[model samples]
Target: HIVAAKYNIRYIISGGNFATEGILPKCWHYNAKDITYFKYIQKTFGNKKIKNFPLFGFLQEMYHKLVKKMKIIYLLNYIPYSKNEAMEILTNELDWRYYGGKHYESKYTGFIQSYYLFNKFAIDYRRATFASQICAGAVTRTQALKELEKPPYDESKAQLEKEYIAKKLGISLDEFEKIIHSPAKWYRHYPNNEKWLSFIYDTYRRLFKKEKLGNF
Candidate 1:
């Protein structure tokens, strides 16, 4: 029904969740052979013990192929750790210039490198974008192109012309994050705010905030 809505309609974009199960698809899935390749990277890069697949196969193939061709051996070694650790390092700063842990540790930061490969050179770019999330360093090349032809959601750029109660009430980013994270908080924090009531009645919001979250 939302898809059938006409021109100039506004919509909220949900974050691409990486959890194993949810309304969103699974974070990762790729070919079986690709898993073996990641294992190789794990051993050579971080010398860590890989417990499970970091991402699914379809997500892996795009960067995996590039890593193969470029002989990018460093990130492969860190495959033993969870995706969270890998992402933190990639998103944050890691000294790839000098190798402290291993000789190849400086080869590639997983997130940045993956973006470089996927955003720049995948054959089925749209398919790759749909398969992986941005935190995995996967940028949607096709979506970026489409936004060129149409108005893109200016989430980061959006300025509230009218002072929101949430903002005027002097809400901090952390507090706002907390409210959005849990259903209970929505009502608990903003009982007088009609938005919270509307959210509680909305079927989608009810489903999304079913569980009460204590921590992010």
Candidate 2:
């Protein structure tokens, strides 16, 4: 209680009931993920014995369902890049590793904020591009021609890229354009700031609200 209280947690759920009685603990981190705290959780509850309660896995399953149901209104793309050549490979493969393995790594350093919201951001990106394309296309012929002839990734090319990305996400091009865009949806608000720590804290705030953090 003291430890949890120090972290401003409201209550502590024990794992003895889960392991011994076949109950499962709630996925509290569904609202937020804190590495140092969950490290403590792994230390404390990771080794508890499992029993045969039918509801043991209920909490996590329910949490997943809730997550799928909640609409993600905002999205931001915080693509990390650098002029340094050696960092390119790392940035290139980041998306794959993020959605797959190394997901838990985000919790450790709060580095996964972009990654965690990326699945949604990708969908939004396609949509926003679609809208931008339509707006750009409806312009005068001269402007349209100019857009078409623009650089390697100009408006037209970007539009096609958006369509391709939408297809990859299994969302129609129309769905992409109709959604809203807000600054809140952006993941990389201040990239030039300190060592990504400010972004991490902002992502945390977005995930759990400005009120408080949860207990493990």
Candidate 3:
């Protein structure tokens, strides 16, 4: 945002509806790519440079959270398009090909979501997305639950994807597996002003009568 402001690039448009819409739509967006890159850097550099100091890490995390909240706010106030409607316009009017699954356009993201996140963390993001869709009246809760029962990706292609992602990231299969097996960590693990920030957020929400920020 600083850079955008410096360049006078106002009115940044984003396709952030799916974060709230609850449908696990195709993840062919800048934010998806940025997340994949962040993960790659974290694994490649071991987070020393990324985290450096507790205060730095805390500030970074807070900034990220703020940006995420801003995106949702932007969607609520300015951009009023739905995932289904956007896809229709893109496919029919712009002739955009549908990319299969969330973030499938990026092989790294495909591997991470389908194999890494699923196998290691047991994080099926589709569950959240499906719930969102249910809330939005785009899909039924029963249907979402049914879909959640299945594997995130094709079992037969799992090994192939793992190999592909490992090679692409210039990491050995064993190294990649090590990362997968490692415990998950969050920004709150670092010393930070999270409580103070939360207090401020809550205060602002109460003062403005705004809805509390949703979990990403």
Please give the lDDT score at residue 114 for candidate 3: 72
User: What's the CA error at residue 71 for candidate 3, in Å?
Assistant: 8.8
Query: Candidate 1 lDDT (Cα, whole model)?
Result: 0.35
**Which candidate comes out best when scored by TM-score?**
3
- Candidates 1 and 3, the one with greater lDDT: 3
Per-candidate local distance difference test: 0.35, 0.35, 0.62
Candidate 1 vs 2: which has more TM-score: 2
Candidate 2 local lDDT, residue 19: 12
Cα lDDT tens digits, model 2, 112-194, are 22222333333212222223334434234455355434331233344564566557556787765553132223312312222
- Misplaced by over 4 Å in model 2 are 1-82, 85-153, 180-216
TM-score of 2: 0.20
TM-score: model 3 vs. ground truth: 0.65
Collision pairs in model 2: 19-49, 75-185, 76-185, 76-186, 76-187, 127-176
lDDT tens digits, residue span 78-191, model 3: 555467777789999999988778788887787777777777767777876777777777778888788888888988888788888889778899998888889875444433
Lowest-sum lDDT 10-residue window in model 1: 20-29
> Which structure among the candidates has the greatest lDDT?
3
